[model samples]
Target chain A: MKIAIVGAGALGLYYGAMLQRAGNDVRFLLRRDYQAIRKDGLSVTSPNGDFHLQAVQCALDPAELGPVDLVLVGLKTFANHRLIELVAPLMQDDTCVLTLQNGLGNEELLAKTFGAERVLGGIAFLCSNRGEPGTVHHMGQGRIRLGELSGGFSERATALARMFNQAQVPCEAVDDLRRARWEKLVWNIPFNGLSALTGKNVTELLRHEPSRREIIAIMGEVIAAGNAQDLNTPIEAEIFIEKMISATETMDGYRPSMMIDRLEGHPLELEAIYGVPLTRATACGVEMVRVRMLHALLELGERN
Target chain B: MKIAIVGAGALGLYYGAMLQRAGNDVRFLLRRDYQAIRKDGLSVTSPNGDFHLQAVQCALDPAELGPVDLVLVGLKTFANHRLIELVAPLMQDDTCVLTLQNGLGNEELLAKTFGAERVLGGIAFLCSNRGEPGTVHHMGQGRIRLGELSGGFSERATALARMFNQAQVPCEAVDDLRRARWEKLVWNIPFNGLSALTGKNVTELLRHEPSRREIIAIMGEVIAAGNAQDLNTPIEAEIFIEKMISATETMDGYRPSMMIDRLEGHPLELEAIYGVPLTRATACGVEMVRVRMLHALLELGERN
Candidate 1:
């Protein structure tokens, strides 16, 4: 399969290097670093190991690229729609697009832009940050699971999963990606908002009792909302919260991306991560007082 | 009557200078600049004008100053109980002490130390910060109202008011100072926490709609807690929230003291401004989810 990786950040770089190594024609679509990566190749350093690869096509213009079988979207959620518009010309009739962005609603966006049949849902569980333009530091787990939004075990989805699994990137093809997305949403909504608001690392925030309780309350609200929407994500508030607390206990001090945005004075994922889930739940008439408070704090903190 | 001014910050300095100019014997219990003030005199600068007097007595040693008639305490709330044992020597059998500290529960701490009869609740309605050791910057309205916590209209309280009035420092005697303290508590509990949590100035915070709404909600909780205590505060939740919103509109660009403490990494009045009120309200069975949230966020910010 000829795969074109669009919106190259840490996740894009990680998959680009892996899929290229697995004997597929993988190209990176980026504007700024095309010349540099074309000259020097891509570098991915992970705790699993380090891989330096050459023979990867890098281009600045999406239209210049030939028709590709799969195009992986790995931009920030805020940039997803614009990038989709930019890369629409590169997709042929059979070309499929996959979005592995954080937070909710990106899949719906991709489905709206492209046909629902061509868009795939993904939950990429990786602790990665940009080491440089061509280098990605996969600090921890780098596993991804892909599924069709319409709950079909299609041949295309299985082939994509087999490709990823053969590349040693653990990939699971699930019947329902909505459950996967909401499960990940439960984790991101609390930890991301807590770390962003308190300016603390994951471990420190979980240790603070009130912060811990508030995050748990927020998760409860999220779970209730998810249940109301009939997603039935299968995790209770206490169980999910305890899972996060236990996970953060071993983390070697990681600041959430939202915190990084706030410290750097960049626009945060305010309306998306903390806002959308609650607003959706409110449509179902679920009370999201805790989530609303977090939204209010984020709004206040972002004021100049 | 002789008076000893505890806490040589801006308000204490202003009060000491005014009392001395009123022909009452006044001595300042201060820190490093005692000798400097004793030699070069004390200076009070205001919009009205600047004035300096050489006859003001300043002492670093509490033993050096004999029995005094009144003690004016105007330190920050964090510094309240810290030097309690050190400042005991300046008080005589009949000496009355007044506390003009910000936030709630200051009077309880003072009463615990100096007995309720000797403790008077004080509120300084002036805009001031530390200009220098011997010099104070007094701006805008300059008035202080203080009275017994027990509703006793004592002669000593009357005498202190007269002395203050004679010194051109507008002074009034209230029947109950606890209510006045709660009124001030409403301001500090919400504004101070919001300022510290967001690290923004008053105008920047209150100008935004979401922030302003959350702030009013938090203040409503504070007012509810106050009314639950039956403290005679009389500030309804709606009126109290409206007043707080109006304050941001009227006062142009002010950063609350909690912001100052966070910027300097000083010990915040987290326990007093947030935790104490919440604890009190919870004990009285008042619902204060916002207060509890503020307390959590402030504590988390403090730890970070």
Candidate 2:
């Protein structure tokens, strides 16, 4: 399989390395880390193990890479506007574009750029960070969930999952991608938003009673919003709340990506994560008051 | 008129100074600042004027002062629990207890202690700060609105208003104190909660588009909650929104008391300002979602 990973951040590098190790030709499209990665490959330090690729292919421009079998987009959703032009040069007739970014509207943006048939919605359940140029630290779980944007089983999604599983990445193909996004949001909206607003990490947020209650309330809002969209979001509020609380309790106080973005004074992925769902819920006449409040707080914090 | 100022923080000292200047016998009941004020007197630097009371009466114990005509309780609602015993020493049958604290339930707490007949609900439209021990800075408006707790006009409320007006502190007697509380909350819930949550002052919060929208939405929720409690919170949402925006636009980047309390690591008056209204709204089946979210955030922030 031939694959090109765009936006070579921690996610791109981590998964690109895994696919490349499985004998797939994985090329990284980079901007800032292009020079370093081109000179001395990519380095990944993981809890699972440490590995360094010495002869990895890297590209500064999308045109440099000819038509690939799959294009995995790991770019921030804020930069999605440039996707139509940037991704045009890397497509074949059957080329699949999968986005593994946080928040909503990424797959739709891709489908609008490419055709809906060639776009796959993907989510990464991983805790990874780039320590420096060309170096990624894989802290915890690394699983990939991919599905069709229009729902149901797809041969391409199944093949992609099988390929990921062969590489020890633990991939699964679900029937409903939109519901999957909302399921992820049940955890993201409260944990990510509160983490940014209060400057606390996952463990600290779950440990305190007030924040824990807030997390539950915000999660309930998200689930309600999802149900309003007719997405059948699967997990109940209490179940998901307990799941997240117990899952985070074992980690060593990991700071979420949004919290790191806030601490470093960078713009957050507010629109995709918060704005889209809120708008969808409101349009359906469902009031997601808690999520809207969190969205406003994060929006204000980002501007400052 | 003889008066006793309980909780001699900024509001207590400022009003006490004003009433004392009008030839009333004013005594300040102090705790931590008792010795500093007793030794050097209380000083107030105001945009209107600077004044120092070099020989003002200061009492460490409420028992030091006999029953006065009026007892103004200006403590944070978090400390109102101690008022039952503390205020018992300074009240006669006709002595009025006026609370100038922000948020709901202060008058109710006072009424629980000194009966409904002797408790008056007062709202101070002022921005003043205590910079240090025995010193207060009056930055902006100092007008006050006072009314009876049980609603309707009363001779005691009218007399108090007249006395305040004579002291150069503009005062108005309102027909409904509960309605006035709801009116003030239309401003307080949003500004105080957002200010504390986002760590921004009034001007900065009103300046940002997202925070500004949030302020309007939260104010709407508060007004709705007020109406649910049968208080008929007079003003409409849009009018109050525009009113607050215009008013905050002209201010000098002033931080509200809640924000200052958060910065100084003191417990917020969350129960009175946020919790009580939220509970009342919930009990009445009014979904005050935005206010509940803010309450949760402030509660979490206070813990951290």
Candidate 3:
């Protein structure tokens, strides 16, 4: 298989390295890391193991990598405006584009850029960060859940999932991608936004009593919003809270990507992560007050 | 008249100087500024005029100022727990205590310490800051609204207001102090919390579309909560929003006290300003979601 990983940040590099090691022709679309990776190649330090690739292919322009079989977009949603133009040269009629980006609206943007048939929505359940250029530190779990944009199992999504599994990267193909996005948001909206706003890591936030109750309240609001949209987000409030609490307890003070972005002075993916669901829930007359409040604060956080 | 001003911060110094200039024996109970004011006197630069009092009375011990005709409690509400012991030696049988603090529950604490008849609630409509140990810069208005905690106009309150009026500090004696506190909270909850959380000043918050809307929504919640408690906070949401917008437009860029506290790394008066009202509102089943969210974030801010 031929794969082009766009936005060669930690996620892109980590997964691209795995697929390349599995004997796929993987090329990284790079920006700041291009020169470093082109010279030294890419290395990943993971709990699973450490791996280094010495002869990785890199590209500064999409035209340099022309039409690959798969395009994995791992850019921050704030940078999605350039997606249509950036991904143009890399799409063949049957080339599958999977977005493992956080938050809402990425799949829709990709679908608008490419055809709906070529777009698959994916969620990365991994804890990873970029070390010095061309290096990725994979802290914990690295599984992916993917589905076709229009729902149901498709041959392309199955093949993509199978390819990821073959590369030893756990991947599951689900029937409802939109609902899966909403389900992921049940955790993202509270953990990601609160972490950035409060300067607390996941464990610290869940440990404090007031913040713990607030996290539950926020999760309740997110679930209400999802159920309002008939997405059937599947997890109950208590169960979801317990899951997050347990996860935070097990993970040793891990900071979410949103908090990392905030500390680095980068603009957040506010519109995609918070704004879209809030708007949809509000349109259905759901009282998603907590989510709305988080969205407002995050908007102010962006300005500051 | 003999007056004892507790908590000699910006507000304490501003009012104490005025009373002293009126030929009253005003004593400031100072902590950080005791030595400076005792040695160099208290100086104030105000829009009304600039004045330097050379022989200002200052005290570190409540025993030094044995008993005063009036004790003005101007400490931050977070420090109010020590009020019982701090103010005990400063009270005579007929001595009155006025709390010009910026949030809820100050009068109750005072009433619990000294009798109900001795406690009065006051709202300071002033813009001032402490420039140095014994220097205060009064930026804007200096009127105060005061009333007896038992909800009626009393002789002590009238006398206090008259004394303030004589000192060129416009003071009004109102019938309902609880409603007045709620009215003040209509402005305080949004401006103070949002300013601290977002790092935006009053004018900038009102100018931004999203924040402005959030401000209105929070104000509505406050009003609803007030009405729920039968305080009858009489302003409509639109009227209140327009009033705040116009006020911010006219006022020069001013940072709320909460924002200043956050910047100075001091614990915010979150419990008094946001927590009390939010709890009361929630008990009455009034969903002051924005206020609750702000309270949660401010709690986290305190922990951090």
Candidate 4:
């Protein structure tokens, strides 16, 4: 299978490297450093250890890549819109585009750009970041959950999972991907926005009574909003907050991606993580003032 | 008239010097740095001009001062409770202690500590900070509105106003001091908290629509809580937000005192500004989840 990794940041590199080691032809579509990587090598340092793979094909322009079986989209939510447009050259009639980006409404955005059948829901559960141009550093566990947007498990989805599993990456196929996405969204919108705004880490945010109360309140809002939209994913606000708190306690100093964006003065995913959900909730006539306020602050932070 | 300036940081020094220039014997109960000024002199830079008063008496202990006609308590809200005990020696049977601290509940706390008759409700319009131990810098208007906690224009309150006017610090005696205090409380609680939590200047906070809206929401919550307590100071949320936006338009890069405290790692007025108001709202059965959340994050930030 010929696979091209779009927006080849850490997740894309991880997928591309694993797929390549599993006897699939993998190419990385990246920034200017893509060509340099093709000339030098692709590097990955993980918990399993470090290694360099020199045979990985890399390209800055999607036109330079050959016809591919799968194209994994790994751009930030802010970049996913335009990136889907730019990576159109690599998508054939059967070429599947799987989005592993965080936030809500990303899949819909991709489905609008590409056909619904070609867009799959992918969730990467790992702590990784870009080290340098072609190098990716894994901060913790590396596992991915992939499923078709159309609901049923297709042969292609399982084939992709099997290939990923063969390459020393954990991959699982879930019956309903939307539920997983919303469950993650429930955590991301509140925790990310609160932490980024306050500049506090997880334990500090969740351990304090007021902070914990807010997390539960915000999660309740998100869960209610999701259920209101008729999504069957049920989340007890306390349970969700505790899970996030546990995850954060394990990674104490780990700044969420939003915090990193705040420090680097980069545009944040305010629209996807904060804005869209609240907008939907308001349109649905749900009182979501807290999340709405945080969203507005984040939008201002991003704009300024 | 003899006057003692308790906790003589910025406002204390400003009022003390003005009183001294009015031919009153003024003494400062100061910290170690100002204690050194007991041997030196007091210098102040104000909007009108800069001057040094050589005869200004300074004391390291409040007990060292003689019975004063008036005592101006000008410490930050964080130190108000503890500092109340120290200022007792400076007061005689007829002496009044006027509190000009920021945030809500300080006057009430003062009344609880030193009898309501002695505690005046004071709202200062000046922006002054300690330039050094013995030097205070005044910016903008150095005016105050003060009256007895009973909300009457008593002879004592009238005398204090006359003295303040003679001392060159503009002063007013309001018929309803509680309303005035609550009005200022409405402004102080939300803006100060927002600025401190976001590390944003007043203009930056108000100019941004999201922050602007969140601020208005928090202020509305405070006003609701105040009204529930029978303080009939009415404020339209939208109108108040616009007023704040316009007021902050001219003042750029000005950090709120709370923000300064947080940055300098000083003990914050979290209880005075946030905890008290939140507690009030809770008692009134008015929801203030957002304000409580911000306070919780601040508590965490304080710990950090």
Candidate 5:
């Protein structure tokens, strides 16, 4: 596959590097990492294994790397305004655009601009961060749930998932993409919002009973909202929440990406992660009060 | 009236000085202000009028103050652990113990220990803070809604109101004390908790529409919880919330006492302000979900 990575942050660099190593034609349209990547190439530090691609296929301008078979978007939702402009030059006639961004509305935005049939939605469970320029640190978990944006199984989705899996990444093709998105949101809305707002890590939040209870309550709200979104299988609030809590506990002292973003003065993925989901839930007549409170607080914090 | 002021913080100092200037014998059982007050009397800077007592009656020990007709408790709710021990030595056979502490359960605790008949509850709208060691800054409002803890108006409550009114402090006797407490909480639980938790003042919070909406929602929850307490008059949520918001807006850049407490590394009145109210609401089958979220966050912030 002749693939193009549009947002060459950690996610883009790491995934593109893997695909490139698998002998697929992968090129990254880079920004801060452009000069360094062209010189020293791309370096990925992973617990799974570390590797350096000495001859990284990189470009500063998207037009220079024009017309790929696939366009993988990893742009921070805060910069969604610049997304279409960046991706336009990377599109071919039959190109598929897959967005592995956090939360909702990414696929819809892309589809609205580039047609619904050409878009794919993927929920990525990747714990990664950027190291020095041209270096991507994959701390843990690199799984992708790839699916058709319009829902149901498709050969294209399956082929895409298989490609990622064969490239040494955990990937699965899901029948219901929206369900997967909402499930991830059930975990994201509370943990990310709380950690970012309070600057408390996972362990510290769970250590306090009241906050822990609130975490569970918010998770339940997200689940309720998710269920109301016409999912194939409604999330079992009790089981899923417990699993998320226990999984978070095992992660040791972990701060979510949103927390890191806030600390580092990067714009948050609030619109994608919070704003979009809130609108969707309310549209479906579901009231997620606690989540709304968290969203409002996070918004207020961002203002400060 | 022979009155002894236990918990001689700013509230106690200002009120005690007012009563003393009214020709009543007022003695304060002091702590940090002991040396300064004893050496140079007490200073009160008020918008009403500034005053300095040349011979302020104060003692380090409650035992030295002896039993008095009235024992005014202006202690922070966090110090309720030491409340009984400190107030015991100063209580007389017919001493009316009036606690002007923030939040619920103060009257109940006093009533449980010192007999219900001897307990009076006063919700003072006093905006005062400690200046120098011997000085109290009466910045804004100083009005007391005095009432018997057991409910309904009484001669003692009226006489106490009359005394405070005669002392140049605005005071009114109320029929239902719990109603007044809850009414104050409808304002306190939101502003106090938000200001303390986020370190945002009233103006900043209200300036943001979402947080302002949340503040109103929490106020409604509190009003519901208050109405559930079988009050003589239920708080009208819409009117009360609007009034509270407008009143808060006029305060310019007002930081609540809890926010100041959190910033100064002082223990918050969490138990009295949140814990007690949450318990009461739950018992009454009125769920204050947003308030609980606020409470939980504040508790977690306190832990940090």
Candidate 6:
């Protein structure tokens, strides 16, 4: 399959490299890493295995990349303002757009612009960062769950999942994309928001008794809100919270992507993550009090 | 009456200066301002009036200050570990201690150390900060409500209130000290915690709709917890919240002491303001969820 990767941040670069190594044609639409990768190839330093793709396809503009079988979007949600302009050039009649972006609204935006039939949304559980120009570091997990934007599993999604699994990237196709999205937020809303707001990583937050309790309470609010959204399976609050907390225990000293953005003076992806979800949950008659409080605080912190 | 001021921060210095100006013999136990105050005087710049106490009494040690008729404590609660030792020498069988501290535990601790009958708890609604060495800037608001820690009105408390009023500091003798303290927290728990965590002041927090809603919610939690504490009268959430918000609106860009402490890298008075109150609320079977959340975030922010 010929895949065009848009917004080639660490996420885009790592996944694109993985797919390319599995005998799939991958073209990356790049900006910062364009010159370096075009000159010396793309380097991926992963715990799984490090690889260098010498003479990999690198495009400065999506127009240069043109049409492809799939357009994999790893764009930072804060830059969604420029998403359509950058992505329009890569769309063809039969081409599908799969956005593995963090939080809500990404798939909806893509679907509205390029038709719902051609949009698939997924959430990535990858711990990765960009190294020196042309290099990507995959610290850990890279599992992905994707489904049609209209909801429910599809043959195309299955095929896509199989392709990713074959390429050494764990992938699954889900019947209800919304449920998967909410599940991802169960971890994102608390860990990302608190870590970014407090400048404390996962371990430090959990280590503090007060913060750990707040994290758990926020998780309960999220679960309640999500369960109210007509989810196929209501998240069991106690079990899910413990699972998320225990999983985070192993990620000691690990800061979420939101934390990095805050520390690096980048705009937080607030609207998609907090705003849209809060709105959605409220529409379902569930008030995510703690989540709303965290959102308000994060917004205030970003104000000046 | 001979009075000794312990923990001469902005609060101690300004109030101590007022009492001394009103013809009471006020001696300040000092650290940072000892030399400047002892050599020159204590300067207070207030909106109502500016005054300087020439040849004011300032002591570097409680032993030097000696036993007094009244011991006024405005100590930062984070330094409570040294409190017992510092205030020990300034005590006599007849000397009574009035703690005009920000939060809950001061009176209890003092009572436990010195006798329940010798302790009176009060909450100050003061807007002041220390300026250059001997100068204390009294920006606005200096109202104090005090009562016996044992609850109900007493002749001593009434006389103390009269003394403060005679010194030009607006004063009230409340029958229920716990009620007044909790009512003050209706403002403090939200404004202080949010401002300290987000680096936004009162005006900025109120102007933002989300944070404003959050502020109101936390106030509601505080009032509920307070009402459950067997107080004289239950706080009407709507009236009290609006009243607090309107009053804060006048303060404009005021940053609470907690915010300043966070910015200056000083230890926060978290124990008196958040810790003791939270414990008390939980004991009353009232879970102050939002207050707890804010406290946790603030604690986490101060972790580093």
lDDT at position B34, candidate 4:
64
lDDT of 3: 0.86
lDDT of 5 by residue, B122-222 (tens): 99887889998999999999899979998999999999999999999899999999999999998899999998988899999999999998998999999
Between prediction 1 and prediction 6, which has the larger DockQ? 6
Per-residue error (Å), model 1, residue B128: 1.1
Please write out the lDDT profile of model 3 over residues B1-304, one tens digit for every residue. 8899898788999999998998889998988988888889889998788999999877888888869988988888889777777788998888888989877878887887677888898999889999888899999988999998888778778988999999999999988898888888998999999899878898888777877888888888898888787663465667876787687777768999999999999889988898888878888899887788788778877876
Each candidate's lDDT (Cα)?
A: 0.78, 0.85, 0.86, 0.77, 0.91, 0.92
Order the candidate numbers by DockQ, best to worst.
Answer: 6, 5, 3, 1, 2, 4
Query: Over the stretch B1-304, how does candidate 6's per-residue lDDT look in tens digits?
Result: 9999998999999999999999999999999998898789989999988999888887787998878899999889888888888888988889999999888888889888899999998889899999999999999888999999999999999999999999999999999998999999898888898889888999999999989999999999999999999888889999999999999999979999999999999888787789888999999999988888888888877777
TM-score of chain B, per candidate? 0.91, 0.96, 0.97, 0.92, 0.98, 0.98
Task: Report lDDT (Cα) of residue A263, candidate 5.
Answer: 93
> How many residue pairs in model 6 have overlapping backbones?
0
User: What TM-score, computed on C-alpha atoms, does each candidate reach?
Assistant: 0.93, 0.92, 0.97, 0.92, 0.97, 0.97
| RMSD each, Å | 2.5, 2.7, 1.6, 2.7, 1.6, 1.6
Model 4, B1-304: lDDT tens per residue? 7778887767788888888887888888878556557666888887799988876677677888868887788887778657667777877888878888776677787778679877886888777777776788887677888877877678787878888898888988887786676667677777777777777778888778777777778777776777676653555556765776676677667777777777777888888778887787788898776777778777877775
lDDT of 1 by residue, B1-304 (tens): 8888877777788878877887888878888568778788888788878889887777777777757877778767777666475457878888777877776677788778788887887788776666666678777567888888787577767877887899998988887676666677778877788788888878887777777777777777777788887764476777667766786677678877788779889878887677777778889999788778778888888664
Q: Evaluate every candidate with DockQ and list the scores.
A: 0.66, 0.62, 0.72, 0.59, 0.77, 0.84
Candidate 1, residue A221: lDDT? 74
**Cα deviation of B225, candidate 6, in Å:** 1.0
Candidate 2 structure quality by residue, lDDT tens digits, A4-111: 998778898999999998889998888888888888888999988999998888888888975899999898777777877777888998899998988898888888
Writing each residue's lDDT as its tens digit, candidate 2 over B195-260 gives 888889988888788778878888888878887777634567677778877887887688888888
Instruction: Provide the fnat value for model 5, as a fraction from 0 to 1.
Output: 0.75
lDDT by residue (A6-29, candidate 5, tens digit) is: 888888888999999999999899
- State the lDDT at B43 in candidate 2: 87
Clashing residue pairs, backbone N/CA/C < 3 A, model 6? none
